[model samples]
Target: MSVESIDAHQHFWDPSRGDYGWLTPELGGLYREFGPDDLKPLREAENVSRTVVVQAAQTVDETRYLLDLARNDSSIAGVVGWVPLDAPNAADLIDELAREPKFKAVRPMLQDLPDDRWIENPALAPAIHALIKNNLAFDALIFPRHVASLKIFAKRFPDLRIVIDHGAKPQIKDGGAGWQIWADGMAELAALPQGLRCKLSGLATEAAPGWTTAILKPYVDHLLKQFGPDRLMWGSDWPVLNLNGDYAQWHDAARQLTSHLNAPQQQALFGDTAKTFYRL
Candidate 1:
């Protein structure tokens, strides 16, 4: 088989279906609908063979919408979606969704929740256990503030596979005052014996206006140094990417940033790590 290139993080959404609380008219170009057709050419242009469509909204109905999309779209090899993880029936719901072949993981939208320690709540235990029992990974949709809790969460269930989305979204644009905390958090997670990984996505948007590869290199380098290629995955975080830059620009910038790695290491970042982490 030919070696694969996967865009491990990406999404397809339509505002009409309506669970996207964050997708308001204020987001400008992103306020409209976006789907596989919109991303097909972009992925093809970068030689990406497949993508993992992640949840942009927090609802079972939205998960169903994505699962239905994945069923028809061969290029969507896996899906990381949402569920009410703290609900009493969360386990049963996870079991049902786990039955879908394309359903690979669950992301709780933890960053938006009021409680930074929400992932550690005893109430979410049932959902967390069910994910383990059903063989689903957890995509930590978190920010830097949640990193400490994430490390605790990872330890509580060491068997559950966890991938940190967007390198815990370091405070890049605001200057690197928080760099040490983000770096320390990554090191703690990476130091865990197993079942932890990180994604090199969403950094461009984190930097917001006037971001370049140079501005992002330190954060990227820290992730690489901490997680290493085996535990780090590359992703587009696209459409949201439109706010700061375009698809090709981000792809090219990532290429330039990681150019120093050898062939195998490069392959791991671009594709292999995501494939193994998501079991895709």
Candidate 2:
């Protein structure tokens, strides 16, 4: 078999679906619908053989919508769906979602929730356990402030596979004041033996306008060192990524950022790590 490359964190969303409150008009370019067909040519151009479509809206109906898409698209290796983790019937919901084989993970929209302590809510415990029982990973959709809490959450369920989306979204447009906090939080999270992974996505959008590969290298370097190639995954973060850069630009930048690593390590960062962490 040929060695594979996976774009482990892209999203498909439709404004007509109306669940995504974040897709506002001011968001400019990303204010439209995007689907697998829209991304196929881009992924093909970058030689990405597969992709993981993640949840863009905090709705179970959206999850169902994505699962339906995955069922029809051979290129979608897995889905990270949304479920109300603190719901009274969260476990039942997880069981119901588990019926779909393509459901590989759950991402509670922590970044959108007003309560930062929500992850620590005891009511979510059963749902977290259900994810473990069902063998579903937890995609942590969080910001830097949420990282310290995430470390504690990861410690609670030591075996639950966790991947921090967008490198916890460091503040790149501003100067690097947030770096220490984000870096410290990430180190604490990655230090957990529970197997934490980070995605090298969403960085370009965080940088100042007219950013380049050199501008992102430090952030990318920090992630590679903290998680290593074995625990780090490259994600297109697609359509949203178009806010700052195109797929080919991000792909080339990632390749250059990781050029120091040997062939095997590069492969691990590009595909193997995501394949194993998400069990894609």
Which segments of model 1 are wrong by more than 4 Å?
Answer: none
Alpha carbon RMSD to native, model 2: 1.1
Candidate lDDT values, in order: 0.91, 0.91
- TM-score, every prediction: 0.97, 0.97
lDDT of 1 by residue, 101-184 (tens): 999999999999999999889888999999999989999988878978887888889899999999998988888878888888
Report the Cα RMSD per candidate: 1.1, 1.1
* Model 1: per-residue Cα lDDT at residue 265: 93
Cα lDDT for residue 177, candidate 2? 68
Listed per model in order, the count of residue pairs whose N, CA or C atoms clash below 3 Å is: 0, 0
